[model samples]
Target: MSEQAAPLRRERRTFALGLLAGVFGLLLVPTCTSCGGADESQAETRPLVLSTIGQIHDIASTLAGDDLRTEVLLGAGLDPHTHRPTRADAARLTAADLVLENGLHLEALLHATLDARRASARPVVAVGESIPAEQRLAVGGAGALADDPHLWMDPVLWAEVARAVARELSDLAPAAAPDIARRLEGVLAELAELDAYARRSIDSIPAERRLLVTAHDAFGYFGRRYGIEVASVQGISTESEASVRHVQELVNLLVEREVPAIFVESSVSVRGPRALVEGAAARGHQVVVAGELYSDSMGPPGTYRGTYVGMLDHNITLITRALGGDAPAAGLRDRL
Candidate 1:
């Protein structure tokens, strides 16, 4: 088999096994009458919408408004790529009226749990997969060519995700469809502005210095959307390890291009990024770890950076400033 095809096959096999295990795991959970089915009191008060990531949770909450209750299973700094569903998570999945995940294997470990939930005739939506296949970027460069799951990095693409969430909310609560649509419109406008800001800010960077180096390839969509070149020490998924050769290659790039900053992801280990900095220093090229970027996860909950827009704003503003571009220290809404 070809080298590229080998990893792809392995990933598919792993995903299949995960799904099967999820199914059997769910079967082992002692069935509670209330757990197996939705609670009557909760449904009447507000239908629950559970999401795998905070980005989707924020979108659902915005569109649902007072009509539904929204919660995210993954919190700040949690890596969904490596996150396996606990027994408590399984129960929460079972109890939730609806489930939303980024899909496209972004939730690599949660696939089985999600599939198990879907098999039970429960409502589960992979919102990221809603994006048309052509619009999605293939995982390129020496690895299996799969769809990149970090669509939330691009505001324009994430707007489509918001629309999908709104549709789901509408179908879940037809009575509140109009209200959901209104909220979606506002969210869309805000995203459009964010997209503009990203473009303008990124464009301000000198052409040669517009390279974005990070711990992983999560920023592919962001680079494609804003015309910046992205290079990383790891592949699309955080599950993959950064090889010594890969780190040396990136360090070479940093030294060659004289790139100013490399970033660490909040959800990923700093070891890989730190390695890059150290590698560059050994070659007599100084590079700084600019700041932590929200990759697989967003900021802490109950803060502006915790929200989807805020997450992108933080990334865009941080990247721009670190690369010698101009941006407000407080970010687009002065909330950085």
Candidate 2:
């Protein structure tokens, strides 16, 4: 047989065997279909792993490595809090082998679609929900922010979510468990490094200027983890409207603290922070609009900022610099 046709023949044999094994309720042992030895190329035919957003996609991709094909349901610059799924989204969920999400009310409108799929026995996991309850933050007073869904803001907390995703993927594809575990260990190490960088950089900020004013309350976890005081006009969810009183209060705090800059979240509109700037200026306090921060979503796909590590690095670098902290101009690894 020609070398070019060898892989095709192996794939056919494997498919036939997999069907027979399924009929007998036996697990089919996976093999490297390309060259008769262990190789990751055959993973191109692996199960489909669907994620709700880019952050989760990065986690799933990191864990799955070359063992599975992972994709994100939501694209860049999309707000998960206010996102409403379309018919195509419903179809994607229906066709998913496993659906992963942040899941602390992050995809509020998309939950029903995911639930419908789950009710039918589809493998859908909310990786972020796996975090310990005590570690989770509560939003506003009672109405909103009851459970903060922005866990990715904290590298340590997100490491736990990555582990949960690894377990879920491994359970679904037992043959690839060993590979998944190995990659997960590496991912955890990177996350730990990112966490350490965040701590050291944020700690260097001048104590009095450690105020993080943003468009929304997506940074509560970040604030709690990094020792910055977070203030936002909108509550946890961007769907909530900001009241005049809230804006006024932020303006007052800005003037009182003489905060130099206010940031706008990438996934949210710039109007909130602009209002704060105007309000602060009206009170004779000039608060410049700082750089944008990745909150509910990651950066554009295919960019460094789009990856999980890049997203956090960008945030830490921006926060440190804007708040008068010491950090490299290019961020953690000169990749900013």
Candidate 3:
């Protein structure tokens, strides 16, 4: 086999094996209806659902309803691409009834730790991998990752992830299947509405100024889904270095298109886009860092921007206003 195909084959094989193992592991969990009312009461206790990122945790928490205790290993603004597993994180990983992750190499540093847990019959799943290969976008850069893990940027695509989370949580807590499925339905409907709002709002931008430039190439999926042209300094993985050539290319595009605004990410350094602005200035073209976007992470907790809906709302609101499109200042539902 060729070098490129080898990894693809291995990934497929691993996923297939993991799927079987996960199902078998679920079967091993004893189901006792003998206690009747007692068992039903205890079922309310819920499982401890651990996720890798806050976004996934939030979605799972919403889907898990009030029953499951969902928590994330990484907090707001942490870059998952380079985050390493600490001793405390490892302890939490083992303690979780079921661990949820983005996968597609998003948690590159924690693969070994997650793998170890899965081998021991602990349920560790990369829910993002549940999105089919055909749906994922490819990115390019020196030493960059092959697939984009930022599926959450697009609500339509994220609905796929929501479905995946519902399946895994249902498997772990069969007694709560009805509740979980009900919540999943509600979440999906909200996401569908959000997707429609995004499409309408983004389409308002003038065709010429609909270009979206950011610090990194995390918006490929977003751009594809929303009908916007995207450019970036770095690759899919934030770990990839930004070359001057790439920056210059983006600067040229900015200048050529006279793109009025670009954006920075909360989790990625502003240095990349900052350089692009300076480079554009040198050539008599001006670009502003219109706003900060939630790329790899979401906003602070207890805030509107912290939730999955809020994250996308912020992106849509910021992009529309900055790109000369019209959107309610507060966003789709005046909830910003």
Clashing pairs in 2: 139-145
Best lDDT among the predictions, by candidate number: 1
Lowest summed lDDT across 10 adjacent residues in model 3 is found at 28-37
CA displacement after TM-score superposition, residue 295 of candidate 2 (Å): 0.6
- Model 1 error, position 212 (Å): 0.5
Select the stronger candidate by TM-score from 1 and 3: 1
Question: What's the lDDT for all of these models?
Answer: 0.92, 0.88, 0.89
lDDT of 1 by residue, 1-336 (tens): 789999999999999999999998887775655565666654576789999999999899989988999989999988998888899999999999999999999888888888898899999999998899999999866665799999999989999999999999899999999999999999999999999999999999989899999888999999999999999888898878988998999999889988999899898888998999999999999999999999889999999999999999999999999999999999999999
Best by TM-score: 1
* Better model by lDDT: candidate 1 vs candidate 3: 1
TM-score of each: 0.86, 0.85, 0.85
Superposed Cα deviation of residue 124, candidate 1 (Å): 0.8
* lDDT (Cα, tens digit) per residue for candidate 2, span 1-336: 899999999999999999888966533233324355445555356799999999999989888877888889998899998899999999988987999988988899998998899899998888888998888987667564467888988888998998899899998889999999999999999999999999999999989899999888889888999899998988888988899998999999989988899899888989889999999999999999879999888898899999999998998999899888999989998998
The global Cα lDDT (0 to 1) of model 3 is 0.89
